[model samples]
Target: MPPAKKETRPSSRAGRLRAPAFVKNHRGVKNWKEAGAWLEWRGIEDIECITPDQAGIARGKMMPSKKFTSNTSLALPSAVFMTTISGGYPEDGNGFSYPEDDGDLKLMPDLGTLSEVPWETDPTAQVICDLVHQDGRSVEFTPRNVLKRVLAAYSERGWRPVVAPEIEFYLVRKNPDPDYPLTPPVGRSGRPIGGGAGYSIAGVNEFDELIDDIYHFSEAQGLEIDTLIHEEGAGQLEINLRHGDPVELADQVFMFKRTIREAALKHETYATFMAKPMQGQPGSAMHIHQSVIDTRTGRNLFTNEDGSESAAFLHFIGGMQKHVPNALVMFAPYVNSYRRLTQAASAPVNTKWGYDNRTTAFRVPRSDPAARRVENRIPSSDANPYLALAASLACGLVGIDKKVKPDQPIGTTANEDEIDLPRGLLEAVDLFENDKDLRAVIGDPFVTTYAAIKRAEFETFMEVISPWEREYLLLNV
Candidate 1:
């Protein structure tokens, strides 16, 4: 039998009692004029307009409050969306290249994503933007736009996806040298963490100050963060956000990552969301829990009125099982991401589904009929949250539309003989590039661009000689 569900506490202790009036009313500063006015009202002097690049990293300009609203839109080069994770152009030219010269694109503020930069020393604010072509259509390669495209598909089907993300990361002592291994930061007790402390209240208290600041910053940014717990890795923690619209949840996850990094810096530590940052430790992941609801009745589409599992639910699982192998590039994009997927690493390595089974890629958590959902455990923390959420939802939609039926759910344990996931970035990229159905749903342009970027990153990684190679192969071989 599946483990019994436990009542979880709200993650934001500060916002749990009651939220401030300003926070309640702040539904993202809606337009250029409204954003400017909100910044002015908050005594903010600088405003940063950011858009997620192909790698999910924020790239944008910081503008003076006075000059920002004067222009209707921010113009940037189209090439910005095609840059590799290492800040270099792809070997085979970015597909968006113009014959004459680099083309220009526009940045339109997504007013719903405006939030104050709580960790900044100066009065500053930031808003996420949507990349738009000169023709006024959204840029196909942008991570945010990709998510919007998938969400639009759901809307056309009279369905909406609700998503909640569980983000895991580690706090370590600040280290500038790439050669040195990271150590857990010294907590309030002035002792560095020595081993894994999953679910230990004492572990949480040790880093109370940093965790507290994270809560405050999350509250200020209006991120609906809900539960906090110590994960299985030393100094690792997980934050759970309440479920809501897929787009809104993606935006919140994007901001929440930046917030945690900034807060860690302020507390004299460093935070890394890398999938596997340390040897002999569990890796961090961005586990996405998802459900769909009817647009008209707002009823849970995964559950039937008779309280049994719905066909839509099983078909959704089937879709994920069939399509996840092709979408592996989005879930584990980096060279380091695959290191976390090893057996016994608390990461899923196959597209098996089970009832509350942690070893499976898809797990159906025990919940009430209305809350029935699927938890995709494949994506790592290093993944671009926008792309990951979009891909996951798109797969489920494909299953529902085609009426795909999943095989019987694994009871307790996943089959050891099940097929393994792509072993590395190269394999995953190949799978993504070759999959026709996945490309159709996630856009051909995005699939091509993303695969190129990951290929470039993988090639760069291949050129490096690690210490392990020198230690083992140099003398012996």
Candidate 2:
């Protein structure tokens, strides 16, 4: 998971509770003007203005509440979006370019996301920032703007995309050193996590205190976690969020990761969203359940009035089969991300669509016509929520636009089929750069920057000599 960049001292023990932000006859703050009043009502002493950078890391300014409410000019470097996961800039090459002076981008608050930083020592408010040029144009390179661009594509066609993300993660003992391996945290039994405890009610009880804190933190943030389950891995857990508008859902996932990590810290265990945190355990995935709806009718576009599958549904599947490989880099964004995509890793290796098959990349669950949708199981828990959703929806929309038809649904395990997706970071990056259909939907410049950053990250990873190299190859060679 992305670590929080800015730190605020606890409002009360790292925000175990929320302030009385509610007012008489209260609803939510619908606009910036209303947000100002809500912040004041909450008696916010500090403000943490933030935006998701390319790696989904929180990036932005922190200031006094008065300055924030006064409409202060909050600006960040445009190049902030050009950073790699490691926080270093890539060398200029391979069609990638950066600004000469790193010009400032104005921060426009997405008032709907403004909320209290419950854990801060002083009453603090946090708001997600949207970037814009000083000249009044949206900063297309930013991750949030990238998702907005894709959502606008659906809006133009009078369609809205809905997504529910099932984010899988792990709880492990603290390993401060990077070279050491991770182990499951000792539970209430005082033993390392036992394996094969999938969906065991008793398994969750092992971390009851921690789980309760997670629920508390999420509740304070108004993040509705639909269900929590002990997953197949030793220390793995999954949280499913209720479905809604793609952008809104993405914001919740972005914030939920932070909440999980904080709760873990408070419990003295570490929560990691790394695609494959431990070597032997199943890799983490963020499976997105998605459907398209007619904005005017408020009906699912995947099904007909007669409750049969629609042509748009097949086209969406066909689009994913044809286009998902090119977009895989967004789903598996890091060097570690590919480790989870391998065969037998409890992950999909191909873009085959299947009817409720766990092995296929796209699984169409058996549901009523109204709930008909496809689940994109390719994204790792580590992917930028905005980019992952944007890429997934963009592929489906392109399929709908081109009238593409899908191959026959697979009945058996499709992971046994060819490994259709890119198997490594650099390979996926190359595919992403060459995909014009995806580039046309996701801004071309943004795609270019993304691919270059991935290349730089891969190069950095290659520089490291893993212990395995010395264990096996060094002496043998």
Candidate 3:
């Protein structure tokens, strides 16, 4: 029999918020008139106001250039916050009531995120937004809002968190069949990539056109992408971004995903940030390098004036070691994400910190005292950048506040007896739901909502039958 046909659900726009009649037609120049003038001067015709959903997907509406820049805020359905990764509403079944049923929330644009859409056929611009309720309260479940809350916590302590992300992804041929494995796209050499090519310069040149376009798009979007290298898996590549504010880096990473995918499509290839896209190959990861800076004197809080490691540094690592098990849901968000955390995949399965060691989840890279930082190697490329950064920073802040001291750093692979992180989505979700301190730090409302959504997704996924079950269990069991 032929494979089952996939569901033809309407695009998310069906459930999206509709503009009020007054604002829909009346596009009078107003609060952000200067922004409108600038877009008009640049010949931009449309603007996309984007919000990061719970699943890290960008959702929003495009408006005429004038309307977008003139309006102080864009309103969206409150239900947007409650959307599950599968694009389904909550299945609790008692009426499906949520904030959107009552009203809509305004999306306030972050002016700093304004950028031209270099890949679009038309003259278009895009900006990231933060969701705000009608009464001016921030929406807690939105990934961006969660990150902002974490940043605010750091601010209260008179410190700023800097983050740099090393993103890895794959370039695969477009495969429409669900049962077939994806193959690498044909490069300029007229051959599909095979086997490992870690750090191979020839492997990079094989698809220089795609790389060049990615660089152009990154520059246009103001993304601080520093280096690109071939990774261990075929058609896999990693790009490192320059470290800066946590929120800014998250925004850049979010935009970078869109940029890379668009460039790939233009070249008739596909780009995926999926945690484990192929079997028997190393998985992609979004490794984050983080550090804290004192607001008063601009000194590295992780290091002392004499260039020795400070107590704060130890506390930061201690906090990560303490909280990472519970925060695993944020780092490895999906079921496929757990598949990438195995021993042979070169992914960290335990929260062990060490100096310049990739085997440990957290590694303190060799750098000058001024550049002291911790590299969180647990998050998968599929993880939401905002939530991952927020969880990491929040845990480190907890360490700083509690003065948690870390154990001795390991110089090699962590012992098999070290603390193991959550093995799968169910365990991670249960841990996240029950961790009171983490819920408080990230926000109780978001924790509750996110847990519900993930649980629903897990249930839905469990219902689907896989080829392995049919091939092995069908004949025997």
Candidate 4:
């Protein structure tokens, strides 16, 4: 792949945002006017102005193309940021939460993210929106804004973070009942997918039609797919996105999730991003590959003048090691997330860095100095991409700021059973709320709001009695 070129917002077009390379490739568009022309040319009827909530779910209003083009005012209650995964609001008041009066926040469309909703028959377009107060103040609690804040810190230091995310998910049979366990969807052979097939070409071909739709949808939206492969678990697939600007890549991830699920529904199946969707199968993960680059020269900062590992590189890893545990709640957000963190699930159990060792949480993949990068394997598939990237980058940035040094890299034979991460959602949230270093970078309000939201979710989960509890403890205890 060629190096990403620096993009400058069009000077001639007032209020134009800088479109990333992928968005720039669409219809030769580089600004809102050009994007608008493309929309008109395509005969778009409706525009979905949306923003990601804490759980990465799209929330906002949908309006007609005329209203969207005319820039009609759109507002959503700030309480949406405080919404739990179960769609419940937390009133525990663990910390100062948003919407004290349930006031509205303005939704400002990010024109660079405008693209056609390929699944819609009415020729609809969707664009990610950013939240702001009525007085034009930025809403710091929004997930996208959290990532933007972290990126701004790197920008101030003349550094830019590049990331490529590999998303793993399962193609499962439709199971509407919450009581029933999910099963792998029947493939072309009309049999339930059995066992792990890991990288077999035949395995991928079993659902060739769905994969093709993914490619088609991705291409239509200008979302670049770096690679696609069959993962270890039955009916599991992983799609790797091309490395690029962190914010733009996050937007792509946010969009890709919706696209994949819509595509799956078209095939009469379900695409689930739950970390542990099915029992006795390898869980899904969202492993992020990241590197820092000098903004001016566009040179990879992880490498030194003599082609050896640079201090900045080690400091980044040191940052991840020091802060990741406290920030684990962001990487593994749900109650079910911890179930996938066990060593037996092929997920990293410790925050140990290793050179090309998959067993470790942070793997420095062997590459040329320019391509040197770290694969953070800790994040689960269910995490919000915006917060996950922000937390990881914030950790590395704080490490560089403090000149923290990492422990010696572990080798392939190191102990694989080290259990260092938070054991459950409650513990993870506890760590998240109290980490001062993380609060300094990710901001204090976000920590408090996020922690309260997670606590509410944990409380909700505690209300349910699981099958295991009924079967094991009903009579024995």
TM-score of each: 0.92, 0.94, 0.91, 0.93
Q: Write the per-residue lDDT of candidate 4 for residues 1-477, one digit (tens) a residue.
A: 111232334444342443334443442354555555556556678988899999999998988766676646889988888899988978657776555488999998887788889999998988888999999988888899999999999999999999999999999999899899999999998898976799888889999999999999988888999998999998999999999988898899999999999999999999999999999999899999999999898889999878899999999999999889999999999989999988655899898999998888999998998999999999999999999999999999999999889999998644367688989999888888888888988887788889888888999999999999999999999
Write down the lDDT of every candidate, Cα atoms only. 0.83, 0.86, 0.83, 0.87
Query: Comparing 2 and 3 by TM-score, which wins?
Result: 2
Could you tell which candidate, 1 or 2, scores higher by TM-score? 2
In model 4, the number of clashes is 0
Which is the leading candidate under TM-score? 2
CA deviation > 4 Å runs, candidate 2: 1-28
Model 1, position 237: C-alpha lDDT score: 92
Candidate 3 residue-wise lDDT, 1-477, digit = tens:
111222222235542233222222112222253355446444678989898898788999899875664424569887777877887766543223365364788888876677788999898888888998889999887899999999999899899999999999999999888788888778889988975799999999988999999999888776777899999898999999998999888998899999999999989999999999999888999999999999999999999999999999999999999888899999999999998988644898887899998888899999999999999999999998999999999888888888888888889777344448888898898898877777778997788777877777888899899989999999898
Collision count of model 2: 9
TM-score of 2: 0.94
> Which ten-residue region of model 4 has the weakest summed lDDT?
1-10
Residues 1-477, model 1: lDDT tens digits: 111222222346663444333333444844454554466556678888898787678889898766666644587787777677777766565342332566887888777888888888898888888888888887887899999999998899899899999999999999999999888888888888866699889988988888889999988887877899998888999999999988888888888889899889998899999999989888999999999999888899999988899999999999999888889889988999989988655898878899989888999999999999999999999999999999999899889988888988887666354457898888888888877777777897887777777877888888889999999999998
Q: In model 3, which runs have C-alpha deviations exceeding 4 angstroms?
A: 1-33, 92-97, 100-102, 415-419
Instruction: Return whichever of 1 and 4 wins on lDDT.
Output: 4
Record all residue pairs in model 2 with backbone atoms less than 3 Å apart, i.e. clashing: 9-121, 10-120, 10-121, 11-119, 11-120, 11-121, 14-119, 15-118, 15-119
The TM-score obtained by model 3 is 0.91
lDDT tens string, model 2, 10-45?
356435244333421122356555566566656778
How do the candidates rank by TM-score, highest first? 2, 4, 1, 3
